[model samples]
Target: MNGTMPRSSLATTADVAVRRTVGSVTTPAPTTTPLRLPGVMDAEGRVDESRLRMHIFKNGGVSPTERGLVWRFLFGMYPCSSTALERPLLQEQLAVRYQVMKRKWQQMLPDSIRLRLNGTDAELVEAVRYFDQRQAHAQQQDQQEEVRDKLAFLELQAQVLFERVTFDLEELQEAIRIIDKDVPRTDRDLDYYLGEGSGNLLVLRNILITYAAFHPEVSYAQGMNDLCSRFLEVMDSEVDTFWSFSCYMEKFSKDFTADGLHRKIELEAALLKELDPQLYAHLVTDNMESFTFCHRWLLLGFQREFEHSDALRLFEILSCDHLELISQQVERARYQERLASKHSIVPEDNLLTEPQAINTDFTFELFICATILLENRESLLRCRNDVQLIQFTSSLQGTLDLNFTLKKAEEHFYNYCKRSAWDYMNGHCRTRKNKDEHFLYQLRSFFS
Candidate 1:
């Protein structure tokens, strides 16, 4: 609604060439031309990010073979603007950084423990030989009293080491413990994570622990294992997976915090109220206002709602935020137009404005959530309490129609924009901080 062309208006001739009708509503025909190998890369081997993102959104997702390289761009492992010549250097730098951080946590353990966990057979054998030789020497010297004193000193050394361990280190160790327990259970049904000895599982544990070590602020959380495992599956390299996961967390890390999560819930609730007042009212009456069931959905990006492959597709699509990017571009264009008009200047046709940060407040993910609710409006309406609502949502796991849901969500977004424009033109829009007042302002300005 920020002066952007409505979805219907933005549709191209090709989009309209094939139409689909659903229950009296006709929409653009779905088309897919996912970017493949050379298509994603320019002559210089730099990514065409805008094109890649659009392809993912329009085509649903890239093919399984291309997902890894495509995700590298999407998650910031390779910057869209970086050339092939620059990428290898960048990869080396990142790999070094990953190892440095990995070692930082690894070195925190006592030598024996560290060697046992990360050492090779030769190193472990050398450690054993060193200890045995020292014990033999002590026995041959017949220094019974000295040996007893040495044992006491060793015990005291351990006690001091324990006492000297930083609070942060203890916290990290606890996070590692939890991550160890969770890694085995993550995506276990998949062949990649099928066994206790799965190398993929080890990689998953390392990334999570390293993430925890570096990001003490939002150290390992319960659901992070699910998130990390997905990245590991796509990006087989340990360093690439860690960095890509870290980049992803930059945007979504807030989702793991209390206030950030509460704000999202409020926004979701506001959206539902705007989209369907009756449904919101019914939920309020049933003391389901918290929308707690949505926690997992938002936290894991609805990873559990669909099968593994579909969830990957959904994550990449959501990460694209294609609609939101379009909205931002529209807003920027309007701003440029206003300046041109004020200064009596002619705007250049090819001038580009600086990129704007994405507004997370009104992301397309919320629309997807709204679409799911409206799709099941009748069933949700019948539920009178939170438990029933939770059960109903839980039962929806792995049963969603991804294509249908995406199409419907897109429709909802277009409709919302149209409604916002209409409300602004009619002078009925009001601004309130918690209730999309800023968005209404943008709408009014866009129309003005």
Candidate 2:
């Protein structure tokens, strides 16, 4: 997150001026070799994450062998600053924590079964006695007092676990029910998850259950099975997949909520208005401004729109947030330059006066959505209503061109940056303090 891009690395004013002559914004194809292990890692074992992200952005993606490790960094399973020595220790810690959380939910199952089967107290006691016998066998030589102390400790621990289960049981049961239904249905056509009895499907279920059990605030959602499947496919290990999926959910868990999804849809509509006003107007006329047709695309990270492998590639690309990161660095450098210049006139706008907020808007995803729409602008325009629009978009399943769409999205992002720089230079920047608005502002100026 804290890396510098040489000024020459990004598109410049001259490039923007020449954009018209060139017909469209075009990024130079990456010349450096794609980063691999050992090279991506320094002698100290710290990853140059910014460089890795930029490489993915420029080169499309990494080899499958490289992707698992790269995604570990991108999704924050391992910090960019953590050394190789620290990661093993960190993994051990996470593994222990994961097991502890997993047991919390698992321990409730006996009680759950008792309730479901209407078992008598005597039967429940028999079940508890079986586990106690194992503990007694392990501690046969312990003094009577020591054994009593251990029993007391166990009683206290059970009380705590009981309280947690009592509070969360209803919600957790509902989450598990939904997850059971969704897991088998998620990406079953793919070779990795193809069979009804795929072990990977079980791994996917455990990760989602663990996530739901612990994160009650955002508990299991329908789309999470798809998201977790992607991580499990790459990471493979159950512990690793759970931790990585949790890290990713830290940022995106809100997307599963009604409010969060509405906000994203609104942002997409606002962006479409800027990028293609005529199309936006047509949707509005047809009362389709909600843009619900693309809801699955956004929710699942376009998992259904592209072929399986390409969708995996696209997920990592979106995770990198390279454009937003670069724009943040550029803004920081410009802010510094302005402060250093004695003759500089600071604007009254909050954008100039206040400290810049961390950029978490994930605008690149919206830009990619806009790129998809604009790519099909003619076809979309020909549709007279929302039903036709949804049908046309649905028919594009596994048919969109990944490379072409990605390149166009990158261009749109670069053009957005250039246009924002132009607006800021001309004293036209609004007093508002959101980075997403800046993206929309730039698109407005670019189209104008």
Candidate 3:
């Protein structure tokens, strides 16, 4: 994870700003030639980078072409924002411009495939090959309808993003297939099965640097295939998908940085210190301290840590609000238990022999991590090995009862930030450290 930087998130601030300005959009320089439709460009015009850094969210909005363009980028698959949202975009002129966009997409696609874009969903699919099935083709008139034009553009988009790579031994046959697939002839509808499009390298590069904005320590590298793939899956419209993916990457930017990125882990360890002085002391005395295992679990958004379906649910839930209760709760518990466990140790006994009761959602939802810690605690205290402690924390996996774990964690907060989950989420803002540190600090007294 050290080599991987966060992907692009450039459009998030722009989307908010653009939304405000859609009402007051200005017309662009008129040109006879088709402007690049699908290529990545700053849909929003320039801003003073230094001054607009934070308030990019409040800037003015889109052009007629820009709205049509941004609409696809921001919402791609989410329901199209109501046209009413763009009521002030001088609708009459914009409609004419959008028609030009339709023509541009047609020019890029093959004739057969282009024809299919005019029909209904079934007709559209029929014009193109599906992943597993083959069907007969159909006929089309020469005249272009507005609906078909827009539909053609969307179909072309679907083909580019959804097309899968093929593996056939005959190189010549594959090449012929590729050429035939691209060129359309006569009245026949072309296969909508996708072909390739030019990679938006600029947008991708921007994604990397912009994602790593906070931590200049990290380099913007590649191999973010999974994130990009998922982005395409959710967003068919190129611009919308790109922007939404940017928003999704915000929480992960820091972790994607270089080895020096330790703000979260450092904070986690700090929370531990504030929580339980005794455990903290024992960990220090034994050279067994710091919680680093949770790094990957947190960094990759726990991709490898949980099952497939569960990952989606996690993303969906995270997207639902600004809630980060689990992280906060775990920090609190780790801190509190540190205090309790410190006093439990006999002078002659190793620190591992003393248990710091963990009250955290992670104990249950991701209870596996806690179990691993507990299993290794005895040895950790005996050897007081810091490196081993780091390794042990990093190895946990498996799906879990997140809500139950949270409930269980709440039970341990009896003397700390004891607010119910609902209350804590709604208004509680003691900075998880206080509640967590208090909990751990009391552990010593509880067992003393």
- For candidate 1, lDDT tens digit of each residue in 354-383? 333333477888888889999999999999
Give Cα-based local distance difference scores for all models: 0.65, 0.65, 0.34
Full candidate order by lDDT, most accurate first: 1, 2, 3
Better of 1 and 2 by TM-score: 2
Taking all chains together, each candidate's TM-score versus the true structure is 0.69, 0.70, 0.37
- The prediction achieving the highest TM-score against the true structure is 2
Error of 1 at 318 (Å): 0.4
Among all windows of 10 consecutive residues in model 2, the one with the lowest summed lDDT is 15-24
Per-model C-alpha RMSD: 17.8, 15.6, 17.4
Q: What's the residue-level lDDT of 190 in candidate 2? A: 68
lDDT by residue for model 3 (1-448), tens = 1222233222211111111111111223222221233332223422222222112111222233433333332333221222322322222223232233223333333342222233444433443433112111112222246534543454454344323312122332233233233223211221212232112222222233223322233323333434543344333323334345544554455555554236655544443454444444566553554555555554544544444445433434333221134335445654445565455432332223323333342222233233233344565555457776655444434444434432333333333233323232222223334553443333333212
The lowest-lDDT stretch of 10 consecutive residues in candidate 3 is 14-23
Evaluated against the true structure, the overall lDDT of model 1 is 0.65
Cα TM-score of candidate 2: 0.70
